[model samples]
Target: MDFMPIFCDLKEKLCLVVGGGQIASHKAELLSRAQARLTIVAPTFNHRLLELGKNANVSLVQEAFSEHWLTGCWLVIAATDDPVINQSIYHCATQRQIFCNVVDDPLQTSFITPALIDHSPIIIALSTGGNAPTLSGLLRQEIESHLSTASLDPLSTLATLAGSLRQRVKNYFPAVHIKHQFWLKFFTDKMLINAVEHHDTLAINVHIQRLLTESGAVSLNENRSN
Candidate 1:
């Protein structure tokens, strides 16, 4: 817990990446995936970086690093091979209170990137707290292999359904214990799981309605509370 794992909403937020090599490109791609408005400051960029810049919200500053680039940036990544430049970037960013990551140099980083699995609405992040990134990647691969398509479908749908039912859930289950029981059933009920597994939207709706209207369900909730 030395490093607090957190997800950021970098959408449209200004992010500066200093360097243009392969590692820099990889970091830039991750930032792009988060929809960060990225500005890359480097004299040269690798081919992948150029390709990514084509479609991504990325700008290229074909010049040497400048401390002025740190102004107004939400975060920064120092991926340059030159330790001097990377250290300069790290110090400047930290002085400005902007979080920074110096690639391969965790001691200089305010944050570390974790191995991620992007299953659309379902995203999993793995980290070794900047101790072993390779281990995190291996763990992510193993976990990804065990995640079946059926499981992903239900989880994604469950997230969506929860959002759609947010207000209804509050209105229908005013009692805190009753609301907890209702959600507990969403995971434990075999019938609901089967409907989600089969991708039967109609059956899912029927099950949800039954859960709401059935007297037995309310009694079960009361029993759980007691």
Candidate 2:
């Protein structure tokens, strides 16, 4: 892969945007959603950007782009209309060892933002290495549609429940292989599937407990044999 895909936890991290237009606003909004402390620097800004600046986590600097703005920033987006300014921002960020994205100029960017599908605890990101954003968006739509029409419960709900039961599963299984086996069976079990489909948390918990009990007994027997 040309670009390694990874999700970042930007909660309270500093991020800088070097424009106040629509594209810059969009990038700022995404960072804000990630709970980043966002600072936008621009001589002029559009209405959307002005509105986003009202948020507690976002700050707007009505001044020309400068290298000083990049100080302590974990990520930077160069969204200025001027190519020279954007290039300068990218170079400055590079010197600071920060990941910088030059909007619409992937070749100059250290990172490219992917189209995201947020299902809360289950986010899916689609990217084309910044080669074809439109195609990436289309693929994302198709996947979202498929997920919505899937026979099973919403993946987010299933993921949330799985997270809540993770500690319990670990405590019950102890052995890594045994824990993996329990999850594999839990996901594929007909009883669990039926309960998830109907949103019956009680039934789901009961099924999980039964599976844990069975697996624990097997594990105990295996240990005794060993």
Candidate 3:
């Protein structure tokens, strides 16, 4: 089956996982990182899951899985070693129109989770549509080695300012082509890279001003004010 990839915002959303072993613990940890309101259902939990629950502050049910548990979940995972129970969980979640992923059973799952490189506000997910998860994990580690906090955080901050900068451009330049050109040059200019590399907001602003000056589309009113 073909799967189109998407990144979900699980913050404050309910997520239910049916299992408590290592695999389930791993999935729960990832969901917790996204700040999901997580519930783990199993007769017992692995030591790691207990630790994760304490840290992520998630709900733990020391009982068998039940259909009622599917009631309000925005997302579901069935990672149990019991095939019958996992299948049942998948059916219940699917019947409820909720997305569910069954561990090691891609055909039974509605979605597949990918190995991710999260430089939050800039996440890169690698997947082979459940065909090659091992390879994806290897690539994720390889990519992680190349990324640093200093490099990613500054660009993420700059990305936050992009919306306001776009609005300013729209208000200042009425010509569509010139506005597009200005942004193109702004990105290509070495100073924009320097500003981002150095985390220099002031330098970024100066580049924006440079865009207006070089675009040659500044209004006559602005020229008169000058």
Write the residue-wise lDDT of candidate 2 on 1-226 in tens digits.
8888989999999999999898998999899989999999999999999999899999999999988888899999999999999999999999999999999998999999999887777788999999999999999999878877454244556678789989988888789999988888877788888888888989988997899898998899989999
Q: What is the TM-score (0 to 1) of candidate 1? A: 0.87
Query: What is the clash count for each candidate, in the order shown?
Result: 0, 0, 0
Q: Count backbone clashes in candidate 2.
A: 0
Write one digit per residue (lDDT tens) for candidate 3, span 108-207: 9999999988776678999888888999999999988888887777667656666568888788778787677777776667777688777687898897
| Model 2 stretches with alpha carbons more than 4 Å out | 149-153, 193-199
Best by lDDT: 2
Cα TM-score of candidate 3: 0.81
Location of the lowest summed lDDT over 10 successive residues in candidate 1: 212-221
TM per candidate comes to: 0.87, 0.89, 0.81
- Candidate 1 vs candidate 2: the TM-score winner is 2
lDDT of 3 at 215: 76
